[model samples]
Target: MEELTLTTPALLFSAISLIMLAYTNRFLAYAAIIRNLSDKYLKHQDASVLRQIKNLRLRIQLTRYMQIAGISSLLFCVLTMFLIYIHYPIVAVWAFGLGLVLLILSLLFLIWEIQISAKSLQHHLGDIENHFKK
Candidate 1:
């Protein structure tokens, strides 16, 4: 087997670490929003607020799944880099490929959660419009 170049694995590991950090930040933001919504629900028990809280909970759950996937991918990327350092090209390639796939899956989940959030906002807007019409 040919000797591995440290630069290649180093760069890959850095990218993976950055992506995981972003994913974690996103999860933290969602969690904060959920907490805020819960606080609002406790202050006033409106049906619309209740619905929004439910939607937010669901979105948070989805985000949690994405966070899990992103973390898993990051782990795989680290393992791949280690393998590459040891000149195990085949296993390294497989691990890197799997990590790539997991990253893609996480992005897809993020997209879905965004769509759900948009829909929830739209529903709230419709309710506001109806209230103003009365």
Candidate 2:
């Protein structure tokens, strides 16, 4: 295995920062959608709207997990840098490895959320098609 260096962990700083930015954007979008959905559900009290609200709730939970994992990844990266600074090369390597694992987990959660979102959109489209057919 290669020696762990401060630069190695520093490299992830920008990548992680960008990922966090993307995650924040997703979260904000979800919030807006939730508010709009809530208003619609209150006005109509439709079963379809209720279903959408439930789906959004699940997606929001997943997004929260993604953000947690991403933030943990960034924390580990910082820890790795600190360990390297303190001359703990072995622990630094482990810290860096853990950070990478957390990043991978975050990406996996993102994929799951995207799949759910796509399925929800497809269902909405199907509803529109059915209405037109009737």
Candidate 3:
């Protein structure tokens, strides 16, 4: 196999940074929506509102996993670079591969979270649908 260069791992730094930024933004947005829903639930104690809270809780948990995976990818990528610097090419390759796998896992979680998010919005849309039906 070819030698692992420091630049190869460094290339991932920007991509991971951007992904982390996006994940953080998603978490912040979800937090705001959850707070609003919780306040509404407290005031009225509606079943639908409660359901939304449950969904949000799941989404929040998924986001946490997504964040952890993304961070793990970055950690491994950094380790890959460190190994390369220490002149360990074979191990560096393994670390780099693990980092890529972690990145793929993070993406999968994001996709699942987004699917759940779309379904969550459907609850709100159901009201509009009911109105039109009547």
lDDT scores of the candidates, listed in order: 0.78, 0.93, 0.92
What TM-score, computed on C-alpha atoms, does each candidate reach? Answer: 0.80, 0.97, 0.94
lDDT of 2 by residue, 1-134 (tens): 67887899899999989998998999999899999989998899899988988998999999999999999999999999999999999889999999999999999999999999999999999999999999
Error of 2 at 130 (Å): 1.2
Q: What TM-score does candidate 1 get on C-alpha atoms?
A: 0.80
Which ten residues in a row are the worst by lDDT in model 2?
Answer: 1-10
Task: Tell me the tens digit of each residue's lDDT in model 3 across 60-130.
Answer: 99999999999999999999999988888999999999999999999999999999999878867998899
Model 1's lDDT to the true fold? 0.78
Error of 2 at 41 (Å): 1.1
In model 2, the runs with Cα more than 4 Å from the true position are none
Task: Name the candidate, 1 or 2, with the larger lDDT value.
Answer: 2
Tens digits of per-residue lDDT for model 1, 1-134: 55445455456667667766776776787778778878887898778667777787888788788888877787777888888878888888888778779878888888998899789788878988999999
lDDT order of candidates, best first? 2, 3, 1
Candidate 1 backbone collisions, by pair: none
Model 3 worst lDDT window (10 residues): 119-128
Clashes of 1: 0
